[model samples]
Target: MRQPVTLSSRGFARAMRADATKAETLLWQALRNRQLNGLKFKRQVPLDGYILDFVCFEAGLIIEVDGSQHADSQADVVRDRHFEEQGFHILRFWNDEVEKNPDAVCSAILQAAKGRG
Candidate 1:
């Protein structure tokens, strides 16, 4: 069953209170520039009853930084399916991948943005 898409701006504020890792912090810098393929993106954007790590509405993209707990494939697949049904393309990066190779992560996000055009 698919849940309704819902979001509240207040949710983002709460999430921001938590400590952000280097990856999330770094990615936020680039995404905030609104220069990714010329499409504006919002950091910690709220959508579909969730607060996304990053979102490019123009591209219908959601960037998620997954910690080790995300190793569970079933949950990931289910989440992806929900977003996919809403015409969103979900991009997931392991926490280490973002912390260690942020540039590459940005590149992938850029590439995904390109796909939206």
Candidate 2:
């Protein structure tokens, strides 16, 4: 069974949502309200003890926007492995990649989502 989300985690998620990075805000504008191929996405979602950047639960897809700090992150590797084990496809894009070519990013995301379906 899935573990319940703790109150602190929920609050953290809320805070993350309110303080989203520039790249995250840009992507959100493109993905919100079923704007991207009509898929529903939730931002800053607390799931299984991690706060996801964006998730399409129906598609079992998680999209993460990362900065330089995430380079060679062992913790991220562990998190990715855990989510993959749970059958969720994780797509990661650098902050610049999202900012530079959101269209391409969305295209890739659409392709991934379609591939999974």
Candidate 3:
């Protein structure tokens, strides 16, 4: 599996400033600097031509903060399939979920990291 190159400091700071979704910000707060179970995480991470909202390489996790834009389940399923094929286990959470019940959202992510699937 090929890992994407790290972004330059300027590029990363810019990306972080770019309009981040609510769930994206919430997850980043939880995953930064070994915050969650001492696992390091990166946000707006480049993978191929796309950027994942959050990724923890140690656990092979990709967290996608989906909003109403993903109401279409069929397309989401297809997209998830592609990610799975690339050896990524994607965990999606709605914006409201993160804003209202961030504890629950983080719990789900931690569960996913433990190979709950």
Compared with the true structure, all predictions reach lDDT values of: 0.76, 0.95, 0.77
Model 2 residue 16 distance off true place after TM-score fit, in angstroms: 0.4
Q: Alpha-carbon error at 37 in model 2, in Å?
A: 0.5
lDDT of candidate 3 over 8-107, digit per residue (tens)? 6437646664878666777788888888877778887666545677888878888888888788779678767877897779998888888899899888
What global local distance difference test value does model 3 have? 0.77
Candidate 2's residue-wise lDDT over 1-117, tens digit each?
578999999999999999999999999999999999989999999988999999998888999999999999999999999999999999999999999999999999998999665
Error of 2 at 104 (Å): 0.6
- Which portions of model 3 miss their true places by more than 4 Å? 1-13, 73-75, 115-117
TM-score against truth, every candidate = 0.80, 0.97, 0.79
- Enumerate residue pairs that collide in model 2: none
Model 3 C-alpha RMSD vs. true structure (Å) is 3.6
Model 2 alpha-carbon drift over 4 Å, by segment? none
Higher-scoring candidate on TM-score, 1 or 2: 2
Q: Best-fitting candidate, measured by TM-score? A: 2
